[model samples]
Target: MYETKTIKEKIKLFFIIFFPILITQVSLNLMTFFDTVMSGQAGAIDLAGVAIGSSLWVPVFTGINGILLAITPIISQLLGARSYDSLAKKVQQAIYLSMILAIIIIILGGLFINPILNMMNLESEVRFISKYYLISLGLGIIPLFIFNTLRCFMDALGQTRVSMIIILIALPINIILNYLFIFGKFGFPELGGIGAGIATSLTYWLTSILAILIIHKMKPFKEYQVFSAWVKPKTKHWKEQLKIGIPIGFAIFFETSIFAAITLLMSEYNTNTIAAHQAAMSFSSLLYMIPLSVGMALTITVGYEVGAKRLNDAKAYGYIGISGGIFIALLNGMILFLFNDYVASLYNSDPDVIALTVQFISFAIVYQLADAFGAPIQGALRGYKDVNMTLIIALVSYWGIGLPTGWLLANFTSLEPFGYWVGIIVGLSTGAGALLVRLRYVQKKYDKQQNPSVD
Candidate 1:
């Protein structure tokens, strides 16, 4: 039944599948935004506390998220080839691999949360708040990892709607939980920032439960050998997943670590500045969902085409995805540019916060085109299972150029936060240029190997 799609139907299916995933991604971010807004309303200290704690946790989760990126591509390729038996074992393997990684991340997150808080030299209130927030949040990291596996499994099987639906269902529950805990509404103890963390932890597990139910009920992945093989985990299958996923883990970790590191630096400043930075970044981040989700779709499409031995179709999808991202970036940048102050003000009512938000977000908007342009390039590379250069690119763009440049701009120069953002643009642009060139070169080389001659 899945094999009956026409070319046009396939493209439409791609977009339809992708659009909901985009919304799911955006909704996930909204969960964070609401959590932040709730904390901010409690107090400036609460806002900054959660922000700092989040900075420490974000890199870890992002790296894990990256590590899991190999899933949809591998599964989709196998699914496309109708290799159901291999697909079943691989699914089990992904879960096993995720479980192992999740444990390490959870321990690391729990162990370091307090130390990182202390290192920030935050106000006594801010430090305590951060510690409380991180403790509860850390417990949910493992569930978050498990949820990641479910999400990819659903998407690869063309059940993207399952993840989307689960996330959507979880959001309202999260909001109600946050409201009850943070404000002590409905007979619950008022927990404030800590309440936000608890609410987040609950929602993480809740969403995973929802995904698990959906995956089980669906025909596509209902027979997954791994899901049924809950008795004894297959060590060989686990290694197979790690073989594909470990590089992804490193790539994601390296990339997210850069942003997290930057946020850590931002936390060292005044609380007001950190709050403002989060507000600015929060808005810029929401807009990124479009290209990022599109990139995800590109991965699935390319993987399927290659597995099906339709390389020309893979190349076509690559072009489509990259062009699509450029258009999205241009449109998103224009809107952000036009409504800088308006968007900034939406997050916080403070005039000072709003004003600073506009400045930073404006600078960020400048390089968004270049930033978005890189999504498909990296997506295509991941599609081809060619991430060996990911570490090099990440190091050069994020650490080698991005972090140092941002520091000089923020500290030594007059640009301050504005310069810090300019550095992000430069890094993204540089990475995009190099990755795109690499994609082109690889595609040509692969085509030549298959064709033997251009003529």
Candidate 2:
């Protein structure tokens, strides 16, 4: 149903899909940004508490969300193949899987939250805030998972604007909720950082409800009968989704957890250090949405072409997405380089925090460059279902190489906190190189398969 024969057309198609996803991603991250800024206003302790809780929560959320993301490529491929009958069933199974994972996470958090925080030797107030923040946040995990599953389905169908609109509607509500709860306005208790978690959870429920309504009431989506004809969960369908999803989950887990781990490790330093680290990390994450959006767009586009058996078109989309990510990264780098000090001041006004945040952001400029290179290629590989190798690469690069290098430097060298940034840069560069090679190999293999006589 969808075809792009020329590079120009492909680029146009890519951006059409890309821009909405970009808005969705940016809007989503802005929720987190507001949470940090609002909580920081409550006090530095509140900011650090939210940071620690997020460090524990984000990796887990992203990893599981990554698993659900498998639905995008799967559904996109099915769409490209024009096998419309099975889409509803696939989405139903993904929802079931998401529910199961959400319960598991909630249970695990209940069991581990106290022990993990206690083990950290954190300040009393910080630990108290972290514990409750996670607990409050856990309430929304199910709805959040469900929302993400639906989002992946919509994205695969090239209805990305739907997601963008939903998030935009929710973003303001989340900020308002954060304000009322954090500052104890309108008779709301002054919950500080914990309020952010509650706001986020409430927002997740709203988004999930909206997604369900849209799918049921909308024309093209309702045609899929995602709700009208409910399908029973089948172990076979779950396995099929998990097989592709597990590797993706671990790959993303490994990557995101490295940042989480760095946050936890920084907890050993003074509160100022922790807050500064989080501010820089948070802004860097905002910048990262650009490349991440491109990568996700590639997953849909490349997956569609691959499903249609248009391997050359898939390859072209991959190249375009990767190049576009790099170019955008260059622009981001310039802006960050020029405005690092100003950006740092936006997060907090403590002169020490601002100075340290500037240093951390300098390192982020390099970090973004590597991410721009690697993330899109990884997305392309997902299109090909080349995920197991990516899992291996992520594990080796982030945990095996990046963490160790950072740990050694942080403890044994003068780089201290900055050492972790160096390690991240190195690790990302390595992963990017490995992923690029993997993409080329897959491209050639598909090429050879299509034309057996090729040398």
Candidate 3:
């Protein structure tokens, strides 16, 4: 599906895959957005409970599921190489791995939920709500992991629209369920924030079931016979995927945890300052989906070319994807700069919060610019299965440099909360530079291997 010969065709193909992935990303984010909004309607306490629960859940979920993300590049390369014989088994093994990971999360989550909550000086009701919310969310972990694994499979096969359609179908169901459970509609109990958690869990199961049904009936995927013959778990396959996946999982963990860390650090500030920071973060995260989708699309295209032994084609895809991402970032920056006030107003009516939010968003323009550069390059590197270096880069950039710098500035200097954002921007820029250098080196290494006579 990714055999584009010209730049125009490559761009066309990239975007076709990209737009659907973008929609999927946005839809997923909207689910979380709606979760918070609906819970807020229940009461401020309910909203706070859900927010606290999510702050812990989001990083863990993304990090663990990131291991399953390896499935995309692996499957894409198999398709490009036309290595069909082993595809189903590889997928099957990934399913097993996901199941194992999901169970571990459920167990660990149950054990640690109370102790973690205890450490935080939360009100009794909020603590109760937070504990139950996480427990309710835990019910869906298995299916969620399975759904993510299937999503990787679909994305790898160039059927991003299928996943997009599935999420679109599920999004409304989630909202409706949230309404029913949160407000006790249709004789349901008024469980408030806990209801949102239940709604999300149900939504996850629905999505996973839909994915299974689609693969069962779908044409190209049906031909693969992924579910027909379940293979026993093989340690070798687990190792192979883990070798590529562990670094990816930790890299994503480090990146996401940095944001969580920033949120925690912001707790010391006044309510207006904290709220403003969150508002800006919410909007900025929405904008991030654009470049993140582009990066994901690049992973598919680049992996396909590399698997096909078309090193030059892969290099071209990396260039086109990164450059296109940056151009889009420029547009995003302009939007943020031009409409900062208007955007801030959407989040709050208080003039203090609005003013602070606008300022925080100004910092986000630089953050987005740097992310536009870094995120896609990381995706491209994954295409080459060059993940270990990305993990190392993430560690040094985010924790070693980013968080420390933010801490120093926020604590010791006048930048205050804004200092954390500056730290994020610097870390992202540094990572982007490192990723660019690494991408160049990997491309050259592949090119040299392909044509040994070259200097």
Candidate 4:
């Protein structure tokens, strides 16, 4: 179905898919933004607690989500190949995998909570609130994964609007709940920062439930037969997903952990610093969704081409995705560069927080451009089912290089928070360069196969 389109048509199609995912991603980030904003209202300590607690679970959940993302390409490829019969089984297996991983993450989150907090040696109030927040948020992990599984299944089948709408609806719901729970309005108890976690958990549950109902009732998904039969967990399918997914998970873990670690490292500086970092990180994360959404759509687009044995078309999609992502990043970066302080003020009113936030945002502008190159290519590689090497590259660029540089500059040198920001810029640039080179190699290899030398 996708093989005959011109590059322009394909790029258009990519954006059609990309925008809905962007909306969904934006809403998800806004959920956190609202949480942080509400927490900030409570106090700086409350804001810090939410930020710290979120750092703990963002890596865990992002990693797990990355693993489950294997399902999208898997299904997209099958759809392209017209292998309709296998779709149901693949989706069911994805659900099984998501469920298992969700349980493990929740358990591990609970087990290590105390020790990790103690080791950090945070102030008593921040530590206490952070613990409660993590525990509350942990309860929602299962639902979060379930929603992701369903979303991936729908996305692979070229149905993204439903998930976007559902999430958007949940956004207002989340805001209201946050206000009620955090401030103890509407007859709800005032739980402060922990309220943000409670609100988020409930929001996930609501959205996941809504997603399931939509999938069941929606006419478009009827042909895939996702829920037709109860299939036992197939070891072969499990390994297939893990083999493809584990590396992607680790890659995400490596990347997210560095950011999380940086947030933790900043905790020693002062409450205002950590809060400012969180504010800056939050905005950058939202901007990141633009390319990330495009990249995700690229995965589906390229996966479909490869499955249909259209290598040239896959190459075209990759080029368009990379170029489009960079263009978008450049535009967003300019906005951040021009309005760093103004943007920072949106999160908090404190002058100190705003000043540091503007500083952090300067580094963010460069990294966003760098991420534009790496993130889409990473998605393209996933579509090509070449994830293992990407994982290695992520590890080397982020932890092996980025973290050490950031640590030395921040802890040992005069740069402090600025050092960590510099390290992030370096890490993203390294990853972008490497991923671009790798994508070029893959594309060239495919080109050679499609057209041999005349000599």
Top candidate (TM-score): 2
- List model 1 lDDT by residue over 174-255, tens digit each: 8999999888998999888888899999999998777777667666567674466554576776665666667766766666
Candidate 1, pairs of clashing residues: 67-249
Candidate 1 is scored at a TM of 0.94
Residues 165-247, model 3: lDDT tens digits: 99999999999999999999999999999999999999999999999999889978899999998889998999989998899
Pull out the clashing pairs in model 3.
none
Predicted structure with the largest lDDT when compared to the true one: 2
Please report, in order, the local distance difference test score of every candidate based on alpha carbons: 0.77, 0.92, 0.88, 0.88
Q: Which of 1 and 2 is the better model by TM-score?
A: 2
Better of 2 and 4 by TM-score: 2
Clashes of each: 1, 0, 0, 0
lDDT of 4 at 203: 97
Q: Which stretches of candidate 1 lie over 4 Å from their true place?
A: 1-10, 223-226, 229-231
Error of 3 at 392 (Å): 0.5
Backbone clashes in candidate 2 total: 0
Model 4 weakest lDDT span, ten residues long: 446-455
| Better candidate by lDDT, 1 or 4 | 4
